[model samples]
Target: MPPSSSTTSARSSRRPRRRRPQGKPQQQPKRSLFDEVGVTAVDPAPFADLGLPARLVRALADNGMVEAFPIQAATIPDALTGRDVLGRGQTGSGKTLAFGLPLLAMQQGSARPLHPRSLVLVPTRELATQVTDSLKPLAKALGLYVREVVGGTSFNRQVDTLRRGVDVLVATPGRLADHVRQGTCVLSEVERTALDEADQMADMGFLPQVRELLDLVPADGQRLLFSATLDGDVDKLVDRYMTDPVVHSLAPPAASVDSMEHHQFLVSATDKQDVLARIAAREGRTIMFVRTKHHADRMAKKLRAAGVPAGALHGGKAQNARTRILDEFRSGATTTLVATNVAARGIHVDDVSLVVHVEPPADPKDYLHRAGRTARAGATGTVVTLVTDDQREAFRTMAAQAGVKAKTTAVRPEDAELARVTGAREPSGVSLVAPKQRETPRGRGANPRSAKRPDEPTRRRRPSERGHDDGRRGQASSGRGARRGNRGGARQA
Candidate 1:
């Protein structure tokens, strides 16, 4: 088909391009980070229907927890199949059993000495204790042993427990690191590990220790990370250690539960304490959050003097003292609990009808956590933040960030608006006697430094007490005091 030069050039230039495929090209469906792998559409169901063993079902039913929460129902099925799970849910969302049940069900054999089959790491010692308490009954029903190793307790006792062999171990990173370094614990045999409150662990600067501990576990072991928020260091942990985790996000990053009500009261500096005392004197269990440990102590003392039964819980207190205070509060011996941020996530008490921010929190996360102390587990509750005129703008910003729409008002201690909002009322004028400490005997085995006089207050703020509640590394001291403060101050799990 020879043609003239001009015609041939035009024909060659216009040669039809290879026909392109019609319609949309074949492509794979994009995957979401939080998709439920190996799981399908579901709803809240009974624990019995979730493939949990009969023993666990019976144990849950005995505790009036026959139904699986949304988080539990979503994560359990995948977790039971030995898949790593990354879960994000709000506080009081029944996350413990979401991971714990699967952790227990997967254990087919008893653990050997110095090695546990499963591990749960928490941020605070109080939380560690609470987790242990919550799981002990269920673990027993499964014929398993759950042991907890936390600071403020006997290390020797923890060692003995490990030597005796434990099926499940709940621990704080700091204390767990100590055990690992001392050869009291070996993680090679651990088949499953869960990091509860992983965000809090990151916030408390325990990620380094957490990473080190995770590295010690077998590379092929299953891991579960549950947190209120999932970002930053938590994401890195998932990427590095987990293999194709099943993600379940039940709540937003800063979830303010539907049952929670927020309010900000504008108070003059002179009347703020009186207003707080009145609100604390209301007819219900209340938790008051202050900025520092000293402030918590002073506020409790002031409330007590105003005839309101109150207890102070802060990182500065000894672990025994902290335990005693929490016990008293839980038993209704003290109606008001004044604390620093240390208790924000550690406490899991029921019927906390009111939470007062005597001092505003450092940020939105702290604010939400402080508010989380109340309105827990679908219970209706109120959160009241007392703010001075100068602090109003800052609080507004924090509230906005925390996804809270708090009703703002200006009122004095005697105003009806104050009463209506916070159930504030006048306190009884009779001063209450402060609880006394038992005196330790001066003997050859006595440790004078560890004992406190009966009537003596926590006198001077030791270097360890300073910045203890901040949940940050100390920039000042580098000796054992600083190390002790870092470990014992915030009561990390």
Candidate 2:
């Protein structure tokens, strides 16, 4: 029916009113980023009762993981449900499997070449290698292939492996960024992501690259972030990307301090070098930490000169050399290793009885990680910091911030406390002389340096030259004789 002009004008002026459907409810906003969310405690259970696949349970049983750690039992179920997670635990607390098993259980089919289904990001190459190695046996139980992508390895080999399918990839941020930039691997296909030691990555200034990689993954992809502490930049990461992630905080976030003992030794300036050498000369494996790379090299050289088998490890070394040195240290071929900050968090050598700080670390985190190198896996260890008069206050502040009570002792090179703490014996008087380097064979091998003939007299100097030498020697002798006479006269007077 045609309406009047006034009614039609009124109808055109009115806005269309929307109505809520009867069954649907009103939508609510997501929780605020800073709101305090309650964390759920893990239910007590074994791996079999935790809803893991029989095959994975068998693999866990094979690896002696019959019972779930608190972190695993708490995070696994939620992760399996495809939720983003923020997990916190101590250094040795079973984080690898807490994220790893769930990520593996979700991958049901073959992955496309250059497109992995899962990614694990670590801050260093050593950690990347270890993660890949640790997860490979577990991956094998599920018919998956795990690969490592790191900076020190051949890029071509990594590319080839990516061109062939990789089910799981454990990589450092820098190397993975290279693969993405080269178009060798597409990260958009990554579904499950885990960032191990996220705090260290932030401390290392890799958060930008981490953010870039996170952006490359699909928006719906699940993520798990694990760190010892979350503050500053790490907190920013959680706020921006994560959507209501379940936060799990475990006590004793850093390495356990119960198994560790700390000491600060005060040293005189003149005796510092001798004291360092004495401590480094200990019998069992000892890791020495210095502040700078140059210092690390110099300390290693000095230790070697003092008859201690020491190797220098720093970022300046090539990757192969670093690996070789670490292998030698682990094999007991090198008893002491002098390293900069690179080895503080990366090294995982077992049975390291002592750690010596040639200089105290700049911050508490550095201090804690340096001490954490020892006393691992429930083993006992001692950490000694060589403090001079000037550094005492700074070290005290650092220890306080790290929540440690370090014993301060005034010590000398010959002190018994050094032996009591480090098990260091008196250095053998003989320096560890380097074996003579082999010379490249010369043409026909004629006139070797060892061909000196004892019968042939050395060349004699001319009269003028001999006279000059005699005058110099006479001057030195006269000066010494005059000094001795003066001393005797002074004593008689």
Candidate 3:
């Protein structure tokens, strides 16, 4: 029983298409702003026309930033348009203002003592403080309030600040978690969330905490995630949380490392200590790198003894102690910091003019990280490594592998070139060795006459006694010879 073509089509049309069981229309999952819109780079001149308040524009102009950096130029418009952005840029590429300016512009008419409208999660306490400092002025100008919640600080104060409510909350994951656990701060009201240094957070193993924090924020809120690299767990984070994020990558990852000046000095074992001292005595703040915690402590002690205000940063230090030492270093109360690999990354301090490797690292990666302590935020810096004669080959290999073309030279305490390279005045009264005479034996072979019994005194014999002993020995030999002669004559007779 075959049906005609029209009858078959009529039957198919009459059959109901499976309808997705439609009670409440199955509320569609909220879409991210990036999913719904496309963003384009905009000039800073049009920010006012784009509806940013006049005061913020004046602040930007006063800061000598006439034009936005590439990251800012790319992401600011998207952020202002309430779109989620995933920004990829080098460390000093002005990503802060990329998100910061838009966050400010969006809060023009917000009332005083504002609730948590925006939240920024950072990896380290130092970074949290730095971000807070960078945003505080702008927040203040906008009649907005910002507060920092980081570890190694007063917990009660953070709770109090949260109770008072803040417009922008800058925090580290651990401390922010503590506040959340203590029921002090609420993330439900966070409309705009930013994860600054997302790669750093993953490196520090804070991704789980970051995930928990993100879960607390509203899913529909605008999100901005900035990182140097988007790989490994960071990529997973992006896939899970960020919706169709507009990725804006300004430069390659290693571009910043390429711009630094790396120099290695070949020094003798005896000269290494003096070379480090001279380098630390340079004009601006210098961070000397050592391989071990004990070495950092010892070097810091020696530098302080030599009249340089110095501090030590290493894993062995307590959190409060580390915080205090870093504070002193940043405030210029201490101009020199002797640290292990702990300060090689995630520490951002301005005006660090020099980085000295008292003991150069074995790996090229370590060398680059140590060198990165200086030359931050597009500022020029010098990195000097004091390599002993035996270590020159290894350091050279590391430099080559790290793509650092360093000027290699022999450095000594008195060399004016050392002073010129290091920007340090020669130490006035440094004595390498003690000025004292050492006694030596006159002859090469051990003196038989000098060998005496333990009971005998080791003093010089008197001149008369020496002469008498010699004469007695000569007479005895003559007497024995004469007796032998007489005996021979008698036998002949």
Give Cα distance to truth, residue 199, candidate 3, Å. 2.0
Q: Clashes in model 2: which pairs?
A: none
lDDT of 1 by residue, 258-279 (tens): 8988888889999898898889
What is the TM-score (0 to 1) of candidate 1? 0.82
Candidates sorted on TM-score, descending: 1, 2, 3
Stretches of candidate 3 exceeding 4 Å from the true structure: 1-51, 62-66, 108-115, 255-259, 268-270, 291-294, 314-331, 340-348, 361-370, 376-378, 387-403, 410-417, 428-493
**Decoy 3 TM-score against native:** 0.69
Estimate the overall C-alpha local distance difference test score of candidate 2. Answer: 0.79
Q: Count the backbone clashes (under 3 Å) in each candidate.
A: 5, 0, 0
Instruction: Rate residue 253 of model 1 by lDDT.
Output: 58
TM-score of each: 0.82, 0.77, 0.69
Task: Tell me the lDDT of model 2 at 477.
Answer: 82
lDDT of 3 by residue, 345-406 (tens): 65788888888888778866567667777777668888888888788888878877766778
lDDT for 290 in candidate 2 is 88
lDDT for each of the candidates?
Answer: 0.82, 0.79, 0.71
Q: lDDT by residue for model 2 over 138-194, one digit each (tens)?
A: 889999999987765566778889989999898888778767877988997898899
